[model samples]
Target: MDVYAANMDRCPVYASFFGAMGCACAIVFTVMGASYGTAKSSGAIFSSGIIRPDRLMQNTLCAIMAQILSIYGLVTSVIISGNLVEKMALHTAFLQLGAGLAVGLCGLAAGFSIGVVGDAGVRASTQQPRLYIGMVLILIFAEVLGLYGVIVSILMLTRSTLGVTDCPY
Candidate 1:
C-alpha cells in the first residue's frame, strides 16, 4: 500500500474537529468561571447583613464581571467557529488550541479573583459604603486580566501561518 508515505497536501475532514473543540473549550471555561463567581458572591451578599437592601445591586458587581468574562469567551468562540475551514491545517489546529487555553485559563483566574475580592468587598461595603470605589477599581483590574487573554488569543488567530514547515529537503 502507498498510504504510508508523507503527504503534506492532504488534510482530513476530522482535522476540522480540533477547531470545534477549541470553540467548545472557550464556552466551557467561561461558564466555569461564571458559576464560581455567582455562587461565591451570592453567599457573601446573603451573609452580610444589609442596612440598606436597595443597594444589593452594588454587591453584585463581582458576579457581573464574571458574567462579562463569559461574554468575552462567547465572542472568541464565535469568531473561531465562524472561520472554521473544512480542512483545518495542523498549524491552525494548534493555534486554535492555544486560543482556547488563553481565554479559558485567564477567565478562570479572573473569576477566582473576583469571587474572593467580591466576598470581602461586599461585606466591607455593607458596613462602610465609602469603600465602594476601591472595590470597583479592584474588580476592574481583575476584569483586565481576562481581557488580556482575549487580546492575545485574537492576535494569535490573526497571525497564524500555513502548516508546512517540516518538509524534508
Candidate 2:
C-alpha cells in the first residue's frame, strides 16, 4: 500500500513535467517566428529608407540579440526540464532558475550594447572598414553570455542525483 501511494504521488509530478515541456516547446517556436518577422521587417525598412540607416542597423542588431537569447533560453529550458524529470529533486529547480537568470541578464546587456554601438557603427561605416570589424567584435562578446549559461546548465544537469531506480513510474 505504501508503494502504491508513492507511485500515485509521482504521477502528478510527471504530468506537470510533461506540461512544462510542452510550454517550453511553444516558447521556442514563438521566438523563432518573432525573430524571422523582425528580420524581414528590418530589411524592408532598410531597403526602402523608411528609417535612417543607423537606426535600422541598431534595430536589426537588437532583434538579432533577442533571437540569440531566445534560442539559448529555449535550449536551456528543455535541458533543465529533462534533468528535473530524471532527478525528481528540489536542487535541480534552483539550478534551472539560476541558469534562466544568467540568460536574462546577458540578454539585457546585449540589448544595451547593441543600441549604443550599433548607432556608432551606422555613422562610421561610410568612412571606415573598421566599423564592421567592431560590430563583429561586439557580436562575439554578446554571444559569450549564451555560452556561459549553457555551461552552467550542463553542470547542473550533470550533478543531478536521480537515477532510473528512483523513478516511481
lDDT of 1 by residue, 1-169 (tens): 3432343443454656877888888778877887787778778887774666866877877778879989878987988888787755667766787887888788888888888888888889888999989999998998898899899888877865543343231
lDDT values for all models:
0.78, 0.51
Q: Which stretches of candidate 1 lie over 4 Å from their true place?
A: 1-13, 161-169
- Residue pairs with colliding backbones in model 1 are none
Q: Give one digit per residue, the lDDT tens place, for model 2 in 31-102.
A: 543354345434443553453455454436535654665666677667656655543433444445555455
Candidate 1: deviation at residue 46, Å?
2.8
Task: State the TM-score for model 2.
Answer: 0.55
Residue 76 of model 2 has an lDDT of 63
Model 2 residue 50 CA deviation in Å: 7.3
Looking at candidate 2, the ten consecutive residues that score lowest on lDDT are 21-30
